[model samples]
Target: MNMDNRRYNVNARSLPVSNALHGSSTVISELEPLHRRSDVVLNEQGLPRHSGCTRLKKLVHKSKIRFGTWNVGTLNCKSVEVVGVMIQRKINILCLQETKWRGEEAKDIQGFKLWYTGKVSARNGVGIIIDKEWKRNVVEVSRIGDRIIFLKMIIGRETVNIVSAYAPQVGIEASLKELFWEDLEGLIRHIPQNEKIFIGGDFNGHVGREAGQYARVHGGFGFGELNNEGQTLVDFSLAYDFKIANTCFKKRDEHLITYKSGASRSQIDFLLVRNTDRRLCKNCKVIPGDAVTTQHRVLVLDVCIMSKIQKRRQVVTPRIRWWQLKGEKQDIFKRNLLDKGIWESQGSANIIWEDMAKKIWEVAKVVLGESKGLVREIRSLGGGIIVYRTKSSIRRTVLKPYICVTMRKIGRGTVWLRKKLRELWVKLVLKLLKNFIRTLRRRKESKIFIRLPRVGKENQEI
Candidate 1:
């Protein structure tokens, strides 16, 4: 609900880069690809390490990453100002869905690199735009079947994989619906485990909570289940760890509707971010730049600064140590060789050795009947085979400590599988249970038939 309604005097040439958070610069330096990994194909146009690139300047200088996602309802050749405003948001990225223009025609715009459709008059197509500096070294993967376009942009030093998607309005056609979700899943799977990603656009679905302040908002979390159109999108959002970017719909004074006359427009467009997505800066938003942009206003996002956070190191302490205790009362066999307390107190520059005794312990427990009882250190993490020799003959064995593993896996119940089996059994049992209701109904009908004056035994029986 705390939406900023501040207006900017934006000019095409000298468009002021807004810094929402800080006044000074703290942009992260352009990265040099790790030379150790030769598989990484270097970008020839990558800004030199010391060169102050414009994209990098905006990262720390500007507070918000301005972005807009709109349906652009008007015909291709119409609405110049609307298109300009969409680009003017200086949108770090723009997702324009249902644009009637083709990719070539869409590229004719003064600013913003366009990722558009092949034809000039497509009923539906999506486009992507990046700052001119970003356009030089940006790669894209468009999954046309799902109607989604993914862009890989190295804005300065950050490598962001942004996906712009448009889901088909819900319908009974299984082929279209299935292909949409399947292609999306495949795209997500291909994303590198470490790369940061943002998925945004006109999902045409509601993802609203039933109890939140914005509950009435245009089905925010894809109106969950109530409207089939909203359900698919919401479910996908949930399955993936995506946080809702546009949480607030209308600012305190702004009208409730964003699209229609007298119709409450509670925000439908979204700027979604993954939990692990790299953040350029904290202050970012989807602001309404111009009202005339075909109903859906321009989304203006700003990021004042970007910096890397140093990861904190955690120190782990073991539960027991042999040398820490005084005498034989300490049954622990393993020694704490690396403990700083022991070294500091004794002032001994000595290394405690486990192999000093030159004893080769067999994998089998001689006392136990089971030959597969492998002897291994508790903290050791690995798998291996262990063979043992008996009095009569040598026996082959598996190193898997089956008993210990099963014991450790105990408390965490298998309710996931258990619930599925339970529900299936419940359905079968419920099928048989319906017979009792049928019997009761039959008895009630017979009693009523006999109560009738003209009803006879034959009539009651029938």
Candidate 2:
């Protein structure tokens, strides 16, 4: 019942109910708190031993990298919500199918960049969204078509190729399906053997729970029954020497099923990785409780990758509280400067200025204190947190002669109020102009009628 021991229940999800009562992988030995040193546990050999007396054979020093695939169905007005899901779930990269955004360029959404490929009309669009931190490392991006997009990034010492694809549905024409496979095969064959590859998206297939002769490509933990489309996926994986990561891990029915309807459930989404780097994957499962506006649930794959640590630069500036020198404080500064043998001054204009400045600095250090350190942080749209430490306060050192004279004549009483009112007026005018321009553009795009002549009417007759 304790949340701190939730990992104990995690292991239970893998074991059968009968195995839990029979102590298959775990022997509680004692029901007391887990921190107790005297609590004895049984090892694999059925030998009683203290919990702390044993050590694990290996320790993995890797970090988890989350990759997700989702058939969002449409991305017209769902950019914010979809990006929010990626951030909340800590997904490093996500492949979105059926984006429904008509564009062939990359755009910013929240703290992520969406590299989408689609035609003028919104249909069969595919995109890949990556964290802003990784954007700089992307070396190449190829927009194959509305159904496929490729991106390559330099991760550590290795180059990783990520392919986001949306295959034709089962009911599509056979020629289109063949063309999709041909394009996919060309992409795979072009990549070097040394680099890592990850292909993820909606394959629209049911691989079933049997590997048959394609055991190297398909794992036995698949969901639903194998069909012709699934066989095509298996053949493609075998040809490219890739493994279907989603079918490698055993999960509950809810986790195994990726697509669900009112009463039908199946798995159509999948993730593929190189067979040699199979150990890089830690787990693959489907996440529930998504908005569920679409029938496809979110499929996630956990991979291990090297962590990137960047050194941050800190800047500090010196600040002096000039306002502290007033009345008696001003007189004291003058008296102190004079006392330091000011009568014995003899130098050129520059030398005299330097000496006087040095003396003033020493005197101020004794009379007034420096400003406290202030840290300013700015969150960038690319998902990086940058902090700036100011060493000194920003003080105006120069002003126009007219502005200074006006301030002196008007006094400080109404200066602040006048400045604020002027700023507000400028802002109001700018806002009105912006709204008018926006309305004009909208009307122009919509071809709304205006009291203006049509094309060539000026030369002809109105």
Candidate 3:
């Protein structure tokens, strides 16, 4: 028989690690084929068993960082007891706004680890909440002149950094943009190239590419404030390439909403990071906390999940009796064959072609590889895989774009940095006042409450 041997190419980055590991773990489930293929991955028994990192260790350890950001209708943290309740449930990164506290005042809370960076405005407080385990990644914390405090947290084994910020609303007309960007510019500049950064918090702006109004699953309405920020926020995001993470839709089949206020309600809450880290965002979700005290909603997200792949496999034929086959009715094998083009009707192909199964196996293998290539796309960008149980770069290939940010128009819109940043505090103070007025007008018209589950409700699964 004439043989045509071909070399198979494996892109180091695009290798289906998730699927390969899955296949290895599923050794017992491997089905033997009518024709055998040559490959060392097979075992003495002709069954493919897994080995080491090749065999992905399947696990269900919930490493979810239940994080969210909210404007907190008022400066009253005490009113948002539901937030604390949500924390007890599962909270890793919790950002609050309208905190109305100085940095010293925030220090009094015990047990619960907290970091607060406040602006001169009455309610421009922003901070990051992390479990004791992740808090160690905090390389530095800088206070933004009592207006806002910025924290840079290093993501586990990633070149990407996390920035938690609360921008001031009040500032002078001349240098407003310059002052804010100056503070932000330094944090990103310090991080090494090829490292990504997810700067999320109440920037009070929706700076993302994907477009959709703030939507809530319940009652044909949205949560919080959804007023379009226009280009002010968009321009800044474009200049710096900060992707808004709110593009992911909430799974509210029936009705699930987080916040409500006035005639028009919207979801201003966020759980954002750079869109470049889309791969790292294993499973992003927005969950509401059952809290009655505050007007803002809660957001939940899961990060860092591997992908799934299904590999085409070939093995020797299972236990079969050639003598029994000889005794069987001639039509029996033909009747048992799958009718979905399993066997070619033309091209001189027949049920007794003996090698027909081998041809089918070859087709299936090619089809499987083509299908898997779609699921496994990380190789398109320059990404690498690190060997497990060791700190070594094992495989490298093109993966998706990492966090490579390029900023423009350093002194475009806001106040210039040449002047004192504190002088621009007027802008934030005015913004706080406007927000307070907006809140008062809305509260007078409606009553807000958290969603408490009723036992009699239909199909109520948590």
Top TM-score prediction, candidate number: 2
1-462 per-residue lDDT for model 3 (tens digits)? 211111121111113224532342223323543124322133234222321112222322334455555555444555346346545657665666666655533442334556666544465566555555666666766666543455566553443355555554434343755566677777656766566666655554423322443121111122333334423544555555554455454445212233454544444444545545555665444555455434555555556523333332433222222222333433454444444355554555454364577554444443322121111222211122111111211121221122100011112344554133323332332343455445544645232111111112212111
Report how far residue 189 has shifted in candidate 1, in Å: 1.3
Q: Note the Cα lDDT for every prediction shown.
A: 0.46, 0.71, 0.43
The full ranking of all candidates by TM-score, starting with the best, is: 2, 1, 3
The predicted structure with the larger TM-score, 1 or 3, is 1
Name the runs in model 3 displaced over 4 angstroms.
Answer: 1-64, 73-83, 104-110, 119-121, 167-178, 205-230, 250-259, 305-462
Give the Å shift of residue 396 in candidate 2. Answer: 49
Collision count of model 3: 29
TM-score of every model?
A: 0.46, 0.55, 0.45
Clashes of 1: 25
Local distance difference test, candidate 1: 0.46
| Residue 120 of model 1, lDDT score | 40
Q: Mind giving the per-residue lDDT tens digits that candidate 1 earns over 373-426?
A: 223222211112223333333333332343223222323446685455444433
Question: After TM-score superposition, what is the CA distance of residue 190 in candidate 3 from its true location, in Å?
Answer: 3.8
Candidate 2, 1-462: lDDT as tens digits: 563454244222122224543442334434455434222232223322323212222222355678889999988778888888888888888998998878789998876888999875557989999987777788999988789999998886667898999999999999999999999999899999989898998999888887777789887888889989988998899888999999899899899888889899999999999999898899999998889346888889998865344533544455666767889889988889889865566789888878878888888888776765322221111111112222233321121233222322222236686566444433443353455446545544322121111112212111
